[model samples]
Target: MTAFSAIHEEHESDKEDFTPGVEPQPTWCPGCGDFAVLKALKGAMPELGRSPEEVMLVTGIGCSGKLSSYFESYGYHSIHGRALPVARASKLANPGLEVIAAGGDGDGYGIGGNHFMHTARENHDMTYIVFNNEIFGLTKGQTSPTSPKGHKSKTQPSGSAKDPVRPLTLSLASGASYIARTAATNPRQAQEIIAEAVEHDGFAHVDFLTQCPTWNKDAKEYVPYTDVQDEYDFDRTDRREAADMMYEAETKLHEGEVLTGRFYRDEQRPSYGQEKRSTGEMPEDHLAERYFEDDPEFERVADHLIDRHK
Candidate 1:
């Protein structure tokens, strides 16, 4: 059988026992933004009609990192600022799997900042969800990469001096195929954005503005809610317009004036999987056969490559 055929058969066999069910109760604090994000994810997963076995959820260190344990799917709770590499490797290893990389702002945009930029440029087929709560909740409320200036936190005891990172603008600038922003409080909108991200063929990222009541009680002036309506001129889809909006939003702290929606999408770029296939590589089953039939020297090389690297 072809490698693709064998992998398909394996997936089919695994799906026999797969069933959609409620996710485990989250371990986040009450009113945590992660809770709403988790709920929106659960609501979106079933709509995709994908079996749990076909899905792989990879998360990073932080309150959002705990998501792997709460979902009923293949999961990996990776180290801090490392979810992107882990998720990228997972997708490359098993291209058939529907991979979703998730983490908090601290884990994704802070220390893991480099991975975010390259991953967007790579245009891999995966959905990245960043719950941007502004502060590092898991580390006991330290100022995160997206923490705005003057926002006090454990790390920034006297309020942050530097401006916060604008993730949406960065993603757009980094050539992300799909980019979006959403608020955790708006569950319906969050779910829709996530669903769209999942359906997008290339690297898709959703920056979710989540609330951190524990650390950001005073930073409520910047948080977005479903009920609040602020005047935003979304009249243009040009890149310059998007960049301007990002700059304006970051500079001016207007209450109830957050923009939440798909900011950019480019479907022209080929996904990593498509590129690999186009290069005439054998399908999954053939690759597996090659691995199993290869001599011990090749086996040793494979072992060394996997063990010594990454």
Candidate 2:
């Protein structure tokens, strides 16, 4: 197993434990779906038996990025569309930390879109929470990548002609080991889904359909939803079946029928860290803990360059 911190002492952790000591109180506009995500995440942490010290939350720029501040865990407020890369580095350095990367749809699926696809492709052992509000909430509601076709906005006053990105399908095609869609409207399912994603060993992507009443007034409130696992017959482990279900869900999203639940999971696949360790590439101990080691590769390389300059 990957050793995160040798000195990290385990203790009983509760929901309140994840509440930051000194940070902004969740300032999302009233009725903003971001509240539900925070709540579900808070609830999921205690369920995982994880302490704030054991978890790390990395977020990108945007309203959703505020999660790092509100969360009590070790946090990183990375730049716009860059939470994933920062999170990836942290996880690679210390895999024992429960790494969670969160960002708004625009921050995640727009400029950071390339990072999202590749992170999933590598099957990184981390939970990625994309607040799919379908628009950029912080930037005054512009037409985001996930905005439906013909969607009107300050950026697209004539209604956007660009087709919305099918995040779940894109996630699947990118090779995420676990993929699911949840919404702020369904807290119970959201909590359960988040918890499951945390427990999953490989890349877990949760497309959270959050509402933005302050903006995107035309966006669906994501109410009266149906959980595919509870109501539909599909194999989560079967790629073809999962793909079919995701297609329907992505289609019905625009048609006003909200479908949410686990769409795909492949537990058989090994996580990036695991693969590296198995191949003798990843050191037994975390790289972060070796900074003081004598003649570490980095120091050796620096010494080589210095001698050449001399």
RMSD of each: 5.1, 2.7
Best by lDDT: 2
User: What does candidate 2's lDDT look like per residue over 124-177, in tens digits?
Assistant: 999999999899899898999999999989999999999999999999999999
Tell me, by TM-score, which candidate is best. 2
Q: What is the TM-score of each candidate against the true structure?
A: 0.82, 0.93
Task: List pairs with backbone clashes in candidate 2.
Answer: none
The lDDT per prediction is 0.75, 0.92
lDDT of 1: 0.75
Q: What local lDDT score does residue 297 receive in model 1, on the 0 to 100 scale?
A: 26
Clashes of 2: 0
* Displacement of the residue 19 alpha carbon in candidate 2, Å: 0.9
Q: Please report the TM-score between candidate 2 and the true structure.
A: 0.93
